[model samples]
Target chain A: DVKVTQSSRYLVKRTGEKVFLECVQDMDHENMFWYRQDPGLGLRLIYFSYDVKMKEKGDIPEGYSVSREKKERFSLILESASTNQTSMYLCASSLGGKGEQYFGPGTRLTVT
Target chain B: AQSVTQPDIHITVSEGASLELRCNYSYGATPYLFWYVQSPGQGLQLLLKYFSGDTLVQGIKGFEAEFKRSQSSFNLRKPSVHWSDAAEYFCAVWSGSSASKIIFGSGTRLSIRP
Candidate 1:
């Protein structure tokens, strides 16, 4: 089975603090994505990486950045956490084709 | 721009009752479509996907979906819903030239009643 694991299932951070969310996929997929899910708003893409050291901005990339130093891992960074950034963060990975994506359990972050 | 719409925000159905969740999409071409289910606090799981060929597709957990080109809809249906089926369902589409991104619908939350 394809497994995507996130660093933390839940986290609490103070305002202005930097937060890092890690994700690792064992399937060796070439594409990885970071999305923040909010009530009513649904899941909005934050960033995505197509290849190692290559990344692209998604619909809502203003307050978040991503890193893909290696093929198996992707990290999402919140430069300075804020109350508005509190949400469930999800990481997904897929083969770069007509393949379905596999998602991590998710990291629920609370910025207070 | 490409987008997905799930008309219903939530739906309630009794155990063993039939269930249907509506989903519509606006895309320039025939889009890659998918139906995913997410239990509370968990990641989304692929229930079914429709790319081409037969319009009707069977998925895991006894769920199925049909693609209607004329209606621009890909609605999910189940002959009988179980209590474990209570979860959020999201309809997603891939319109990008590459499989780099997918636009997901707001999602429909399913509630099961005894």
Candidate 2:
């Protein structure tokens, strides 16, 4: 089975603090994505990487950035956390950008 | 531009009652349809997918969806509802323009009543 693991399941951070959310996939998928899910708004893609050192902005990428340093590890970075940034962050991995994407259990982030 | 729509925001059904969740999408070329279920506080799980050929696709947990090109809909259905089936269902369409990007619906929450 393809497993996608996130570094933390729940996180609380203060305003203006820098935060990093890590995701690792064991399926050797070439594509990794970061999305923030909000109530009624669904999941909005923050960023996605098709390969190491490559990234693309998604619909709602204003408050977020991402890095893909290795094949298995993809990281989401919040430069300055704010209350509006509080939401559930999800990480997913796919083989070639098609088919089913394996997702981690998600990290619920709360910024105060 | 492509988009997905799940008109029903929430649904409730008694156990053993039949259920249906509607999904509609808009895209120019051939569309790749998928149904995913997200349990409480859990990640989304692939329930089924419709690429081509077969319009009726069976999925996990006794769930299935049918693709209707004319209506541009892929509706998920289950013969009987169970408490375990209570979850959020998202309908997504694979954007052909990209290699691995998908447009997801707002999601429909299913509730089960005993």
Candidate 2: tens digits of C-alpha lDDT, residues B19-112: 9999999999889999999999999999999989989999999999999999999999999999999999999999874547988999999999
Interface RMSD of each: 1.3, 1.4
Best by lDDT: 1
Per-prediction TM-score, please? Answer: 0.98, 0.98
Model 1, which residues run further than 4 Å from truth? none
TM-score of model 2 (first chain only)? 0.98
Give the TM-score comparing model 1 with the true structure, all chains together. Answer: 0.98
C-alpha positional error of residue B40 in candidate 1 after TM-score superposition, expressed in Å: 0.5
Model 1, B14-103: lDDT tens per residue? 999999999999998888999999999999999999989999999999999999999999999999999999999999998574754788
